[model samples]
Target: MGWKWGFFTAAMVALSVATWAAGYPWLSERITPPHESTSLAIEAVGAARSAGAGTWAPALLREAESNLRLSLAERRRQEVRVILLRNYADARALLSLTQSQADEATRTARLQRGLAEVEASSSLSSASLAVASAERMSRAIPLDADGRRHLARARSALIEARYHRDNGDPRRAEELSEEALQQAQDAVTRANTLAARYVDEEQIRTWRRWIVETVAASKKTGGAAIVVNKDKHLVTLYLAGRAVRSYRADMGRNKLNDKSRAGDLATPEGRYKIISKKGPNSSRYHRALQLDYPNAADLRRFESARRSGELKNNARPGGLIEIHGEGGRGIDWTDGCVALSNKDMDDLYPRIQLGTPVTIVGGDGSGGVFSRAIQDAVEENRIK
Candidate 1:
């Protein structure tokens, strides 16, 4: 009986040992949280967020977070179960999947952010160049209110784009840069269209014909002639059919068209003659050479326009046009005259007398101001 009892006790001891050995590993693992997998998943999620996953890979980041939540829930569920019955296989799998999702999110975010940075930088450069080109065009061509507004808006957008790029919002920067580029291009287009007539070939040819006639008259009379080129911003002095001297000149505030009526701020076009000269004490500017603006041709055009109802009922063909002083301001600001510097006027005033031919024309049919502006616009559009 003693031997039998001992054998049964030994057998019970052996079974107890086997049970402890089988349950101890699971008990140790489940007694607390799934430290290894939980830590790995958390670290991976943190890495993904640091890589800008929230902005560039939001869907993948959300998925990673969701899987991590599920993993923690599964771990908690298994922790509450009896030690021998607990199985953390599902929790481990979820944690592993969460880590993978986080890693993928990190990779995707890095790639996308890199691409966006490159694109944003390229767009910003393009926008800056477009705005610069438009500004140059604006200086050469007079833009209406709407066209000027477009250029202003483009400058504002470019500034905002730079701000966003500095703030780490590359996507937003890219969008604003694209908007700036378009607005600047629009401004350029408007400038080109507005200056088209001034650069027309036929109109230039007519102006050239007038120049030839003026030069012929100078040669015949053995005297000097004057040619004012609005596009070139030059007043050229021709002595006996040959150019002798030239001076930088400014034109009327609205110099794009021929003078039509009183209060129309346009320099007169066509053949004219020096009617009178005013000294410094008498003229508003330093010196002045008055021109006969309402010649027969001007009267005819004014009459025709009035007959066609193109002008107001009371429109008058304005006179008192002149080549005067107080220029070199580097901008067109005259009422309806060609302006030269005081020194240039002093040098020119004595060279010509009354009835000397003074022809004012748009351009000399070369690559003038308007031509350069149109070419720039076309090239910029082609690049776009």
Candidate 2:
């Protein structure tokens, strides 16, 4: 009986050992953490975030993050369970879902970044064209402080956008490019509105009339006349109704408008004559030929403007208008005068005697410099 019992116990022990060997493989799988899948999911989430997934694929990113959190929590729960009962199946499933969502989010973000790069490049090109247009317009009709400021801002934005585009931030580049385009377009619009006056039919007709009458007078008297075209920046000498010589001229600080009153800083537009000539020694500039401003026509206009409330009651029609030297500064700087280089003034001073007609007009009837500049700009815009 004792020998039979010993053999039975030994057999039972051997059977227990066989069972543990077979089940160990299955139990080890369940008890071990899903470390590989969890790590892969964590890496995917990091990649998505780096790809701007939050902005471009918020929904997918959120799901990925949430699933990753749930997976980690499940892993922790499994870790706390009895070792024999521990199962990582739920954690592994959640990790798979997290990886899927994170990878999708990354793909979506990468696609958006590619599209944004293309859009940013196109927008930057458009902004460059607009800035060129504004530059042309500004040359024709010099912009005021506000217009210049807008143009400067546009250029600055364009530069910044290019920097971002070259550095792999296409989304930010696209936004800046859009801003540049708008600002440059605004500058163009303002310039166009201001330049409209250069093409007014009535104004052009008046300028043509003045030029014709001055030439006619010179022809009849066989005397010299001066014609100043503000838009052309030209001072033309006419001898007996024929143009003999021309020189470049600059005008007032605000040269666009006719002189209205004191401190207006605009060149006067009308027929006048040299009332006085100051030589190099006495003149503030190298030489000066004074004109009789506030002539009958000028007075009439001034009085009318005052009546219309365009000028103050005490305002005086400023005088001392002249054709002066010390010019060629390449800008409008005078109070209200036509300026020439010292050499041009010296050549003209001797020939122009007192009472020589000086006809100043806003433009020369024919499309002047401003018009040609605008036309070129339009052609360029069309081509681009």
Candidate 3:
């Protein structure tokens, strides 16, 4: 039980993700990150057809989630299957053990000759039952090491309990048999915990897979590619990020020194990956691209200062954030987050795929389109 929760979670996740089987031959169940440099997206199209999931045709993943959710609800209700498995296992174990005891009482079994057969059969039946239960739920929730210990002890007690009764110690034998039953009763709770955990794992796994497939389909739909209009000091969207819709945007008064620390008003310059997305509900901007802007370079720069105790606690508050719609009337001011017109947001609300990459730059800075720090990480080796 030391890590029972974690193990249960992982098993459940793997089980739930198994739910999304590609029906057609060509659609791939897997997709690699675009940074892999070799596009696996193209390969996935081939897999989709072979698997019978159909061609790389676009379908709304949000709708898929609805369908998947209904299926999953049905999957969870199969808890009855767990009880059926347990009953089957109990029946098999009891039948075998009872038969062995009857034989031994009649002198058909000896210490060395008969006990091993009973033990092996009992173990096999129990294991089979556990697997049956696992199959019905999501993942197998076999007894943990502690549970196994109890089960082993219970089996041993059954053997000894019967031995005592045959040897004229009926009360002692009854006590031992009762002890075995108690251990099993305790294990019932543990088994149920594991069963429930698989349920959660299934949910999380389902969501992540849905996100990947949805993003992939969106890519195929082909919006404007990302673009920047420097002279106008505005970033434009193409089919990808391009201005299938565009909005009037204002750049920092001075784009050279970006806002690194949370309070710094300067905008950041780098290749940012959107890690999280939230809807119109805003604590900050109106919907946002929460960028993973801080990199190792930024960390290393402040490390010495941190050791010397000169820098503020825990590096700069690192996200370079952005969202559509200016907070109020036209403003050329921002700490680092970008501002887009309300009209632009209405257009962007549906199209902005999560995990989209946004690159920042100096109005007239040198180096690559991506920030120097990010470019170095990508070229030096391959940074995640």
Candidate 4:
């Protein structure tokens, strides 16, 4: 009986060993490496956050992260532990999807922001250039009704664009800036077209040539000349065919056109000579350099205009146009005279001789005979 019992016990122990060996892999997979799926889910959540998922998919990310943490915690506890493999897998998959969506959204947002900034910058630059061009054109020539209207529109648009830009609406600002640029360009074009009616190409060419010749003559004669550009509101001094100095000047109240007669309030446009100079006590202004108005050319034009009924029969060609001091007022307030500051007059007084040439012309300095002449002479010297 003892032998039989020993054999039976041994058989039972052998069967138990075989059963444990067969189920070891299955038990180990279930019990060891706790929260493996949860860890994978956590890694996925981190990837999503790193990919900017927070910006585009905040709620989804929060839900996935919360579920993963809860699952991991429940897995650590023994009493209320639940099978979380499937749950963790689902959370990980969801997080991956969120990450992809967030990445795409983030990329799109960055691209859009970059494009907006570039467009806004370009539009602002273009608008600024257009406004400057329009302003220069307006100052040089009288703008017609349509030109004025367009210029006003452009200015309004530019102001609005600036407001929008300050308010953080870059897209709207860009649109408005583009509109402003277009309107400003249109105004410039219209103004130039109207100016063409009053100033022919031949006149421009003649002015340019005269300037060059005058500079050459001055250089040869070792003399000085004065040039007043009404539109530029500037006076330039040329000595020996080279520009020596420039000064701000104020013109007549109605200085846009050539003076026709006394009390016309228009500055004359022609060549003349400074015939006399007077000190502060001897003149009404601080100082004065009297010019010879109604020179030979002026008389010829005055007579012709009278015969053609362009000027009144009794109109007398104005005289006594001078460059004087005590100016510095922003606007043109003189009566057909070029006025300068006291300081500028003091500087000019000693440099000017009695016979210094003075030439007054309309429009910006670009087409002025004086500027062109100086430029040409300078260029020639450079070439030499």
If both were scored by TM-score, which would come out higher, candidate 2 or candidate 4? Answer: 2
TM-score of each predicted structure versus truth: 0.89, 0.80, 0.32, 0.48
Question: What is the TM-score of candidate 1?
Answer: 0.89
Tens-place lDDT digits, model 2, residues 66-87: 9999999999999998988899
For residues 1-384, could you state the per-residue lDDT of candidate 4 as single tens digits?
A: 999999999999999998889976665555454444555566666766664446545655566666655555544543244543312233344444544444444555455656776788789878977776677666655567898998899999999988988776678999999999888877866765554423455665655565666667778888998878776678889899998999999888764567888898888887889999999889898999999997999899999999999989889998889999988675788998999999999999999999888888664436442233223323433111
lDDT for each residue of candidate 3 in 1-384, tens digit (9 for 90 to 100): 859999999989877766544422222211211122112222333333333222111232222323334333333343245533312222223333333333332332233223433544444344334333322221123455665665566666667766765664444565666665555444433444433322244533543344334334436666423333221345545553224544666544333344456566545555455567666785355666566657555556556566777667765645656654553334446666666666665666566567665555443232321233223323432222
Best by TM-score: 1
Quote the lDDT for 345 in model 3: 57
Relative to the unseen true structure, what is the C-alpha lDDT of residue 159 in candidate 3, on a scale of 0 to 100? Answer: 72
| Per-candidate alpha-carbon RMSD to the true structure | 2.8, 4.5, 37.9, 9.6
Tens digit per residue, CA lDDT, model 1, 1-384: 999999999999999999999977766665556688899999999999999999999999999999999999999998888866777888988999999999999999999999999999999999999999999988888888988998999999999999999999999999999999999988887887787777688888898899889889888888999999998889999998899999999999886778899888989888999999999998999999999989999999999999999998899999899899999788889988999999999999999899888999988768767777777678767223
Worst 10 contiguous positions by lDDT, candidate 2: 375-384
lDDT by candidate, in order shown: 0.90, 0.88, 0.44, 0.72
Error of 3 at 348 (Å): 2.1
How good is model 3 by TM-score? Answer: 0.32
Would you list the clashing residue pairs of candidate 4?
A: 211-369, 211-373, 212-373
Model 3's alpha-carbon lDDT is 0.44
> What are the runs in model 4 whose C-alpha is more than 4 Å off?
1-190, 197-200, 328-330, 363-384
Off by over 4 Å in 1: 1-33, 382-384
